[model samples]
Target: MDVIKKKHWWQSDQLKWSVIGLLGLLVGYLVVLMYVQGEYLFAIMTLILSSAGLYIFANRKTYAWRYVYPGLAGMGLFVLFPLVCTIAIAFTNYSSTNQLTFERAQQVLMDRSYQAGKTYNFGLYPTGDEWQLALTDGEMGKHYLSDAFSFGGEQKLQLKETDALPGGERANLRIITQNRLALNQITAVLPDESKVIMSSLRQFSGTRPLYTLADDGLLTNNQSGVKYRQITIAVIISRSTPTEAGVMKNSVLVIPLLSARKTLRASLPTKGSRSLFSLSSSGPWSFRSSLWC
Candidate 1:
């Protein structure tokens, strides 16, 4: 039995190094899984594997401690340190709404711009990597044409029409026939550029990555003259419901608001028998579970 155990491949120095190398690869994979999914199970498993690796190395005394120390230190630094850091961040206002510092929030709010009742319906066509914009004033029914439209300092190709304009060759010819151009055809021209921007019920025509990121972290619009300072925008969900037989019923109304503020004060509904007195605010709020019995 002793002779057979001596002949085993694992007893060889090369096989021992190969086994250690494979275990190191497994540790790397576990670390990546923990990072991507933020799963605690992966972290726990990593610690178990690391402990086993350390035990095997110390017991065998085949490899030097230098390699073993680095692997154990790396597991502690990347895997365990991040887990502790995330738990610490959970207690703080690390979410989008309360993201920036007070000074940064003020700067972002001061830079916000809005144009009232100004609408531009755009027709976009693409050739190669560039896109053409045919801008039409919806109310005036006037179209403006340019040979090229520059975005991020790059010019888009503009196609010329053979026919004369109805208004004796105004600044540009108008394609007044509504729904004349098929959406699918426009999409085919700029398969990647053609997209709908849902600001509200009205879908506007535009391309995404519309803004270029400056080295200073500011976003500059490639088309319009608007410049926006980077800020954390929070999505707030407000739900109102009635209390029935000492239990709060399902939410009857839901309102979703995107803003940079922490507290949202909305008027409660007055029609219910039991009125909503006030909402108890909690950071990462937890609701009590109710029994149906």
Candidate 2:
């Protein structure tokens, strides 16, 4: 008697190798994409899926694994990993008190500074390839010039009685829309230790530092001579006040307000809440959890 032979899905070694090769290529593409975008976590998940698929197709003993590879890969890439990440993020403390990582916190605190320096009105002079910043200090009676490459230093401006305009005293600003030399804003320090900020095409001024951040984490305001520090505790308070300075008592923080104003503004409340304007004199306020007190 002759025995009958049945062909299985992975019976062809060529087809199995083809499938494995294709999965490997897909995983390689995903790895490159994720790495470029800084998504290292997702790249690892893709690598795991590729390994499982390659093992199932390349090994004859694991031929039966072909039937479940698609479902396994789908779950690992889409469902399981995302659900795990969501749960992990829920447990981590990322409120206001712990808003940034250690590195980012240090950078932010170091960059916290205010200007209280000399003021100089500026004019923009676009010269085809580059732009020129012309600064004038009326009180000091000086004129300075700077460009993209080098500071042109002080340039003599022959002032005449006719140069002075009437009441409006427009600052010789001529906007040539074709050149488009203006920037939205530029906050940078000059060689003279003065900060220059260009708010708009017509408005640019020089400033000096009025506040400095101390190593002890205090913000010293040079103008008012006030030292301010960040709030490190967790305090729950009424949302009536939105100022920076507030009183702290035990675990509760009392925000000081010179006066309280309540306006009847209409709003739609969430489910199981009172009408938007139904609150009494002790008005209702909205708040969310934060790291700051």
Best by TM-score: 2
Location of the lowest summed lDDT over 10 successive residues in candidate 2: 251-260
- The CA lDDT of each predicted structure is 0.42, 0.49
Writing each residue's lDDT as its tens digit, candidate 2 over 1-293 gives: 99988888777778867877887887898787775454556777878877886787677799888998898888877899999767755654334434554445545545544444566665655555455556666787766655443223333232222222222222344542322333323444455555566534544464435546677665555665655454432222322334345422122121211111333222224432312222233322222223323
- Reference-based TM-score of each model: 0.25, 0.31
Clashing pairs in 1: none
Query: Could you give candidate 1's per-residue lDDT for residues 24-70 as a string of tens digits?
Result: 78787777666444344456656666866556564646467646677
Off by over 4 Å in 1: 1-74, 84-99, 123-134, 144-293
TM-score of candidate 1 versus the correct structure, residues matched by position = 0.25
What does the lDDT read for residue 159 in candidate 2?
26
Q: Distance (Å) between predicted and true CA of 51, model 2?
A: 22
